[model samples]
Target: MKWSIVFLLISVQVFSQKIIWSDQQKLEWSNFKSKVKTMRNPDVVAYTHCGWEYSSTVSSDPSVPVKIKITTIFREDKSWKDPKRINDYALLHEQKHFDIAEIYARKLRKEVMEHIKTSSDYNKNFKIIYNRILNEYKDFQIAYDRDTQNGMNKEKQAQYNASIAEALETTK
Candidate 1:
């Protein structure tokens, strides 16, 4: 039996400098390694660049298990912050953004596993599912920022923090 392996790294933009997300690893001010040339918005304190990547292997032998790996990553070179305006609250907010990406990564893993079980053409199906989920993930990210007002509104931010934490717990 032969094994076919496929790998894909999808993101809004390509990045080489990245840190994989982990439960033990938390975001710190130092992680924002980029220096912003100009502030597009004066109110914006920081930006966290996070996304997901996946790879899968399929075995021709039905007895062999399929291998799918999904990873949530943060791009240090793409993320930046205003050091003067930084605070613990803002850092936590950025951490939650990374957590949100991890949540979506888990979602993608679940969908990929389900699709591969019955898919005759998993490669094509994987792209289709990935693209669909990617769109949703982007929209969700936008909504999160809008709802929390970029973590300015304490009440909304708290709500999102609780929601995101619950999601991570239940998904695990």
Candidate 2:
């Protein structure tokens, strides 16, 4: 018997060089490949673009199980830093942002697994969950920058760094 599989991918529209999040790999100054642009707020020294994407595959045969893959990615081409102002502290802050994206990607994977077991409408439910998680992830990123004062507040930056490290440990 020949079994068929259907694949569905959901992701942002950007087509750029991306690096998958990995525990063994950490972000470096070289990873920030985009040309630095003047921002409205001159205090902004760097930007890190990180996010998650997922794809689902369903087999035609009943015996074959459905599979879902979630990936956390760093957009190298879309991230940038001001060379004159960049430092280790600022790099740590940016790394935390990427770490947060990985945490959310794991959360989405868990949700998809649980959801697939219970929901009959996989695609619709998956989209809903994906959107909700994406929104939450974006909000958290904004809050991180705000609470840390864009890494200028050393104390808050340390707190966020610790929090993100703990989350990364527990989520995996």
Candidate 3:
């Protein structure tokens, strides 16, 4: 869980159909054409299944120090839209959800690096750190929807977008 990754998308391997997040790669309305869950509430407008994937390896050194890497993925197939609410503004809101995931990933990366560099036991602390950050990420995602009223508040949505972008840069 103590990752010391160099930079963004260092390895371009196709882990799956997941589209790794990027500023250049904005999600289009066409990307929202996937079918929605039938059992879900009809009132819901859209869903963005943004998530993170992590991998770890211990160094060859005797200590077997752990190295963890976390990457966020926007699960396009799992995500869906109501079709009626599909618009630039709605898509922007969805994009912010993905961007928010990146913010947490960056924060997680920074924490793991600092922990590995300073702590005596990296492996033991990895899970604690990972779980803590993961919890925070989930909370923030919910708070985002609540505060912005599911992207109805353009002002709040813009603020969240700015905060996410700034968090990403500072963590880098």
Candidate 4:
């Protein structure tokens, strides 16, 4: 009986963590897709679900090109109700991802050449920098998560600011 109860509880929690993007998330993601269309000239899509925060590109067909997937956290909180703020957050963070992807699109050939010539440490450092960039973006996500729990709007905005600062510093 105890084991069954625990299983049910876990299942409830897992089901609760679902993607339910607000209209604001959709609008922001739509704008993001428009911008990326010009920048990447490829297919783009954004998905938001509770308890998950990430994005990627995938190729479903051999002849078809890769498509973008901007997955973000979908919290059941008041922050998402505020279209302006959440839109701002989504735009900023997803743009960073898009910008990084665009950089890779342009430099993949060069990076591959450099990766072949450089020491393992160089490749490791490159990965570290890439991770730093991602972390810089996630700083906003952390703030959003915290805000959703505490209703700290200012703190959430500050997270975006900090993320931008950290991203700039990492690039340098």
Candidate 5:
């Protein structure tokens, strides 16, 4: 008699530059140290790309605890800038974009914590919660860009900044 073990392979484009967000460690233009892209589209002088990595694990025993984590990542290589045109104001807008990512991470943590009790089908439930939070986060990010007109609208920018700050506190 013999036992068999199977492995699943998943291919993903992994970025080497991954910076986890922290309140004490504020993002700076220096942190945007990745090489800038040569194809500098005039409409898009600078970009701050962000995302998250979520994972969970379960033990063979049903009584074993399930572990889960959601990490907010800032892609330095993907996030580019045109120093010739990127100004302090533009940098603030980008920083705010990163802050928005942290906001969602905290919110996701809260949601996941609440559902930890029901770990019978952790993967399915986790996906539902993760996707919902991610969708909402994307929607808010787009709305921020549109409402502030990419930070050109000073009034709207202030409002968004204030709102994001407040949201950060609550999520914590």
Candidate 6:
């Protein structure tokens, strides 16, 4: 009987907590890591929506691999069974940007610093592209949130749509 009360309290707390990562999330993270490794970007450690911050930078050395930290969302009224559809997609999307940036950086590194003493151009160009990517992603996210609102089972249709929209945006 005592154990049952404890179980009840724990269940209540859990249910009250916000949804975050799922089993599928772990697999998704692993797959993302695998794909990113292929991209050969050393500075990015991990990508995640939930973490110490939305995104951050890390140091790298020959002795240590650069890592990006990813975090999951905090407890909210939303369902944990269905996390944001765009969560992983967003990470992958950002990873691609990082890869592009790394490529651009590498190319720039090959040139003499005297040729372009300022990092302003690269920062500006990257910001424009990044904003466009994020904007389109947001549009998809809005559509998805709307689509998933009517489901009884809380299926992540919004997440699915967001993922698709992000992919299309990237490809374009």
* Candidate 4: C-alpha RMSD after superposition: 16.2
Best by TM-score: 2
Candidate 2 Cα errors over 4 Å, as ranges: 1-16, 36-39, 59-64, 118-120
Q: What tens digits encode model 6's per-residue C-alpha lDDT throughout 66-140?
A: 222323343232111122233554444433333223233333333322222234433334345445544554454
The CA lDDT at 121 in model 3 is 50
Better of 1 and 3 by lDDT: 1
TM-score winner between candidates 2 and 4: 2
Q: After superposition, how far is residue 155 of candidate 2 from its true place, in Å?
A: 0.7
Q: Give RMSD to native, each candidate.
A: 7.0, 6.5, 6.3, 16.2, 7.6, 16.5
Global local distance difference test of model 3: 0.77
Please give the distance, in angstroms, between residue 169's alpha carbon in candidate 2 and its true position after superposition. Answer: 1.1
lDDT of 4 by residue, 1-172 (tens): 9999999988975665333333233334433212111212122123222332333333343333332233334433212222333445544544443333323322332333343233443434445544554564456445544453222355654564476456444533
TM-score of each: 0.81, 0.83, 0.80, 0.25, 0.82, 0.28
Deviation of model 5 at 141, angstroms: 0.6
lDDT of each: 0.83, 0.83, 0.77, 0.39, 0.79, 0.36
Model 3 lDDT at residue 69: 79
**Between candidates 1 and 6, the TM-score winner:** 1
* Model 6 weakest 10-residue run by lDDT: 75-84
lDDT of 1: 0.83
Q: Per-residue lDDT tens digits of candidate 2, residues 38-156?
A: 35678888999889777767655544556788999998888999999999989988999999999999999988888764324464487898889999999999999899989999999
TM-score, cand. 5 vs. native: 0.82
Worst 10 residues of 4 by lDDT: 35-44
Candidate 4: which stretches are off by over 4 Å?
A: 1-28, 31-144, 147-152, 169-172
Following a full C-alpha superposition, what root-mean-square deviation does model 1 have from the true structure? 7.0
Off by over 4 Å in 1: 1-16, 37-39, 58-66
